[model samples]
Target chain A: MATEVLQQDAQAPARAATLYHIENPEVENKAERFLNAFAAVLHFTDYKALLDSYCASSAKCGRCVASCQVYQVSRDPRDIPCYRSNLLLDVYRRHFTVGGWLKAHIGGGWSLTDALVDEMADIFYRCTACRRCTLECPLGIDHGLITRLGRYILSMAGIAPKALQVSVREQLEGETRNTSKLPEPALVDTLEFLAEEMAESLGVKLEFPLDQPDRDYGFFCAVSDYLMEPDTLMGNAAVLYAAGDWDRWTIGSRNFDAINYGLFYSDWHLERIIKRLVGEAKRLRAGTLLIGECGHASRSACQFVPVFAGQDELPVKSFIEYTLECIEDERIHLDPDIVTEKVTYHDPCNIARSGWIVEQPRRILRSFVKDFVEMTPHGRTNYCCGGGGGLVSMDETHEWRMKVAGRVKAEQIRATEAEIVVAPCANCKKQLKELVDYHELPCRVMGLHDLVLRAIDIPGGKSARQRQDEAALAATA
Target chain B: MEHWLELARGPLFAFTFLVMGLGLARHVLLQVHGLVTRKGQRLRQAPWRRIASSTLSWAVPVGHLDRSTLVMTTASFLFHIGAVVVPVFLAAHVALWSGFLGVSLPALGEGAADLLTALTIVCVLVLVAYRLMTPRARALTRASDYGVLGLVLVPFLSGFLAAHPTLNPLPWSWMMLLHILSAELLLLAIPFTKLAHVVLFPFDRLSEVHWQLRPGAGDRVAAALYGEEAHV
Candidate 1:
């Protein structure tokens, strides 16, 4: 019933309280397609159990209102997580359950009209799917999961947003085979340039090994790292190099990008992407799939890999976890003296929402930085940077993201008064950088590894002047 | 007037109670069947420990006792306690249930039941006022939510007046009829409406145990949606 577009308002928007129309089509049955999608969703899997439970349950307590950043910012009724979820659950109750049948037969009941479809499309996409409400819900109703299910059903009806749809198509079938359209040669060139830049600046040279066989860590970072966040890639590379002899890991030539936008929407894409990734990892005989500083990417892998590949095929490890292990083992020494500024960390919702990667990064941060202050309600209760669930990728929503979506997060970040906000997730980093910039906040937003790249000590690493003198000495000889 | 009370408290009451019991039981059985039938769909073992702990922890849900929600949550907890205890443990309702099925628990004393009933009414009024005043709650509340709250109040209020005959505005027979009828209506509504969450909320956490979307199902979904040539 939620159909209205978000207007500039602090009060929550009311959804379609009464649905009157049912669609009747002569050429194509969109309602039929939606119901078919619903039926297929029910028939092919056990999501029905969840749908049934959520429909029968979901107490409409509005306690989730306290946790939703969007609702907190916009104060629109439509943004309330449970209300947003009700747009889908009400349909389930009306059409799929016996009680709904009675309501339709005895009295006027809701039908899947074009307006309702449009409403679901508009409202479901509006959520960040951070799952903070899941924690707040006394009944444990996962409004975030329901939001994803709504999107999944909508995408099946060919009603997904253009940005998400096009990117997945390109990653699966496009020539470059990654979301960023980063060509292999260009990737190699970028890595070489980064390596050269590091050599010239810090006298550190790390290898960007590609397609090497039987490595221990098959590196899969956000493919965007090749184009945008190069420091994260270099930091991961440097960390891995300093941890081992540096030859035990390789960035597989095939399917190295780990940002699975499928995790944002469609399971078909999630499964397909993971299969391609596992195929690459298996092809390399890599021991573990080492994910870079992307939160959603790491989560989609750590949780869904075993769902597709079973328990024994491959293990997935985040860069944070691996770096923590290295630090613990004294394999990589972080020079605490390098970072002197006040710093705080933003727990990417995907990683820390479930208490998975909460402390590992903090332990790593405290090992180096000075005057680390946590954002209010940090850790598992941490607010999303407002660009989660692939919201940051929609370049069109830049204004809304900064103003409405990211408002609470911006407030939280500003309250901390920390200079550097080390966000580990790709989407969080992009959204937060824009957030801080648009708000004119004093803090700098960067990846956790971006700072770690400055703080880590490389053994036998020469200074830029030493390398310069060597060049001169070689020339003289 | 006596006939009206007799009708509400007798076969009509039995019918509504039966509907609620059978309806809720059917839901439980259907969910179980839904879970068990899917055992063949996938071969993964259930993560029993995570599921068990998650379901139980939300029983108290102390974590949700943040500063903002503390009052509402505490009221909700107390209101629910009153709603359940006053009905089942009341000396009068126990005699009726014992008469029906020859089974009864130790009933609360008359004064205790009166106090709890007053408390339940006060809590419901607080809850209703909160829902009405709070914009977020008002936004979430449909007509059904208000109806359920009103339905809850009817039985408790009417019963209270009936018990303390001195306070009764209506005749004894009318108060009894109102109490009996409203209570039955509430029973009939519980299994079919959002009130079902009273029993079904735990199922929300346990739903993942049946998450057996077998290996090739994604491809099947792709084929079903985007045709056989759809990219996996």
Candidate 2:
């Protein structure tokens, strides 16, 4: 029955995926032939020059390998940045160097066989492409970028995991970015439920306006929020309740999810996801488009979203940054009640190095939690949770991911012995949760807002009516 | 001796003129050709880029890149001492020039050039040693980086030799040519290698100015225009 269910869910999406058309029929044939022809001219190409220019101004030091969660978990030499990059580098050498292509196709260049491709694919997939490695490389090589592009090329060869394909297809369709596609009506109901909960809990009457055209702020949630992960939604509710700024933030009925699978595979899909976030904001007439606590979404929103949209500025802030702003403004008074225990913060890889969102969360954690011990290799140099880079959604590698991908993070958590682990990103939460259960660790994992909600002491805070409204919403679930 | 000096002066003057002229021409080509063809070129032309490229980046790296900044500052607090002392006191470089103009300024008495040369040698060695020792620097260390140390060491080694007479004008001229050639090769490699970061100084600062201007207009428009239904 479980296998049948899995097969049905997998096949359903693949069938739908065929309907929404994006064709480069030539991509397969051309790519194959190009690989064959370019095998000869690879030596003559400026690919190495391009790679070197992109890698860094100087030689890239592999100090970041020490911080990689995948490498830490796997303990495989192939997991190292130098090793992984060199694999791609081999392809680059083969296609660009005379001997490399000849050797790849024939026998002597550098062993470019199908097995090598699979190895490269595995190495690339294991990486969250979190950009943590970029920080430690004194030369500033963003190996994640290369790894992401490598995944894209591999997927073109129809070698991507079945689970990743489903999620990507769902995203490509109008379904949720996670494969747990909540229908539009279900999403509307969830918003209503959150609103009622917020009203009852905080006594601040709010409307989560569905499909509102252009408001002050378009609150974009991760697809997980509307689906199985109700805590992300509830935590968001708790934050909005804590803030009591109903007029300022509005959740869009349309364009709900911000999980761009294209972020995992294709530049085009990435662009579309970014656009949807902005368009939702514009549609709502939102002055600012605030995103929830998801690493890739925020990274996309903070960095690539604006870039892809050709916008001169971001219309919104990542929820963490936005929350920080609110706290700084004295909009939400944080009272340290629920979070009295010693706790450490885990910097999500996307936020740390790629997005450079290192300080804001630390400042927030410092303010909310009493004993905020920082994990080793903290800030822009933090390690990945292994469940990043579309791997979290890819169920095929679940066992390896739980065991190997999260090894570094689990070690970090264990070393802290902190009662609570605060990670603002959703994937971090998911990976940390899986690791906690799998490793049988005592620590709890949560979002920034969850901690804030639990700890906030509303001095003359919410009236009875608001408290009742929040209770009603919580009861409905 | 006079005839040989004449031969050295003519080439030095000619090479300096030719190289500097070419450098200027190449700069123009890079700026102009790049300007006309590259899309989104205007975005780079901001004041922030100018200030950042010119000032911030080099300021930090400069101290780390060479120990002479510290040693020279310590010796001549304001950088004025070495500036004034090295060129005016160096006998070979000054005499080589004066050979053409037919005027020789008196050296800064005895032991002065020797003292400055010794200081330069010490600083270069200390700086090279520092780079070799620091982990971050050591990790990035390359044969070429050391090659640069060796290249800089030549002038000091040869100048010291020429001063004492272990090497006469014949070998001195050869040493001087080697120094000039190495320096020239280093210059050409500047724009292409990590050394090109010296050039990035201006461009890096320029990018900072464009930071306020959103480069994501296309992204937002693209996002809005399509993918209303798509969630990923």
Candidate 3:
């Protein structure tokens, strides 16, 4: 029966109403009201005008369709980038444009129905907003922007995916400072546990400095890294410690998590999250803000922080760039023999395409790895990890994420024939891990710093076991 | 027929140019106004050089066109080149420009212009066939798309027939009048239709700041709609 249902869904891509059954009448009414309010907002006129411009000039060249992973995998007309963009474009035309007004008086024009709204919500969310399609589009029509706008409009209607909505709300209004809702005590415990693990394995005691004021750098990472990606956390601590910059760096009790769910859904949430990051940096009195291995978070802080938080404030930098700087300055020594496996790097869309942090990761990887192969189209032109634009966070979209969006990336990785895939972004790491599992690829997925931790040598920091063993030998002497 | 040709060459031509020029100016001015009025934090510096380079790169088939869609891309490229180059460089067009604008630009030879006109017509036909045949293209195709293609083809076809009056079915004067009328119609339709892209394409490409996730003006739009929440 489940297989039968899946087959039906595969056949009918436009049946979004059946897919997402919003049963509550009150909720539906509220959503509709919110959608109306969003539409009525005067500032949206600019978007309407932009949409109008697109409608006026769009050639429907279908160039973007060839580049779209979802469309390429699904082979569904509805999955085409232009077709997806037209969902919102149709809405803008129906109500906002002068042509729309004329058509309304003349009759036989499109009207925004509940089903159409539901369809827009359904299709828009399916896109990862990788903007790969935008690079190829002759008209420079950003289908990713259109998808985001459509999702934003639908979100206003309260028709957003529950996973994204709940997380954004929690980050903004919940007890915890981050989206993962990790409490202060738990965060400290997690860091300490990671340090102990590192000491046990690597013969070095790693310290996670917290809330130390007047630090040179304040480090922020995805809150999920504490629970799920302990190795990544350890790697970060290990690199910082090896660089002898541990004393100058600190993570604050508040705003330690750099993951911003807002960049995926709401501008309101994006602004709020960015404000928190800026406020946390100010409170810590850090000279520079360093974002951990999370692409969207790094992009949000690096690109939007200057705009939102003021240019004169603490400079935002990616942890990858910091690591590269440390390497260039010889602050940390790397033993290349530590990682002998064939490796390739996956460029996170936010990092490469959006932020232009392309070469830093490659330079770091080259410094350590014996053999580093590149995917067919690496760097700025690289495909999304199929988990970009918050798709990794949307658990409900997992099946679709793996099957449709992830197909291209899985193929890209498989083509490289690498033993290990180093994805710098936490979101890409998670998505790549899933791709590895789903595709049954032999490669292991890891963070850039994971490789760094394996290869890095700390001068004075010794393991507890080594220290104990040395003391016993001295006693025997 | 002679009277109609005289009117098309004189008053009608001037009127079409006026509308095309004014419409293009208004469209460009509105976009500029949008950029100026947009609120929120702006980029520390505009990436003018990168934008110009990116625009040039995107204008050709070398970098921007995907390999899978080469046929359509190549066809589109040929059509655009012919559409722009042939019109600007044709001896007749040069003569008109010399008379109207006091600019006696170099002109393409008759044979070269004829060959380009033929290639452009063939390209347009191939594009129209692809639009009708391909499922994805068919899905995106509208009456306006076909109308634009046909509208463009008319001037090219009429111009070719006028150039070769011996082989033409219609009278030389009538063919000339049809060519002028069709070209005028295309010019008039520029701002009102997809032809607006001809003028807006450069601004659209150059205006986008590549480093930022959203366009530079995007934050202001967010602020205007979402209020204080968007402003931080």
TM-score (all chains, Cα) for each model: 0.90, 0.67, 0.91
Worst 10 residues of 1 chain A by lDDT: A18-27
User: Which CAPRI category fits model 2?
Assistant: incorrect
Candidate 2 structure quality by residue, lDDT tens digits, A195-268: 68655555556667666554566777677867655655666655665676655666675667777666676554
Q: Write the per-residue lDDT of candidate 1 for residues B1-232, one digit (tens) a residue.
A: 8777777888998899999999888778767776777654353455567667777776676756877777788788788889999989899889998999899889998888989999999989988987898988888887778888899999999999999888999988888888998899999999878888877876777634543345666677768777899752
Q: All models: lDDT?
A: 0.80, 0.58, 0.77
Candidate 2's TM-score: 0.67
True contacts kept of 3: 0.30
TM-score of chain B of each: 0.92, 0.55, 0.86
Q: Supply the DockQ value of model 3.
A: 0.37
Ranking by TM-score: 3, 1, 2
Per residue, candidate 1 scores C-alpha lDDT tens digits across A1-477 of: 232222222134464331111122222565677778877776776688678877886779889999998988888888899888888887788889888899888987657665566567777877888989887787878787888888888777666666777778778888877888888889889979888876664566666788999888899998888888878877887787678747988887668789888787777788788888888899999999999999999988887787777544699999999999999999988877767899999999999987889999999999888789999899989999988888888776677778888999999999999999999988899999999889999989999998888877666675324544576698999
In candidate 3 the C-alpha lDDT for residue B174 amounts to: 83
Evaluation by DockQ, superior candidate among 1 and 2: 1
Chain B of candidate 3 achieves a TM-score of 0.86
Query: Which ten contiguous residues of candidate 2 chain A have the minimum total lDDT?
Result: A16-25
Order of the predicted models by DockQ, top scorer first = 1, 3, 2
lDDT of 3: 0.77
Pick by lDDT: 2 or 3, better one: 3
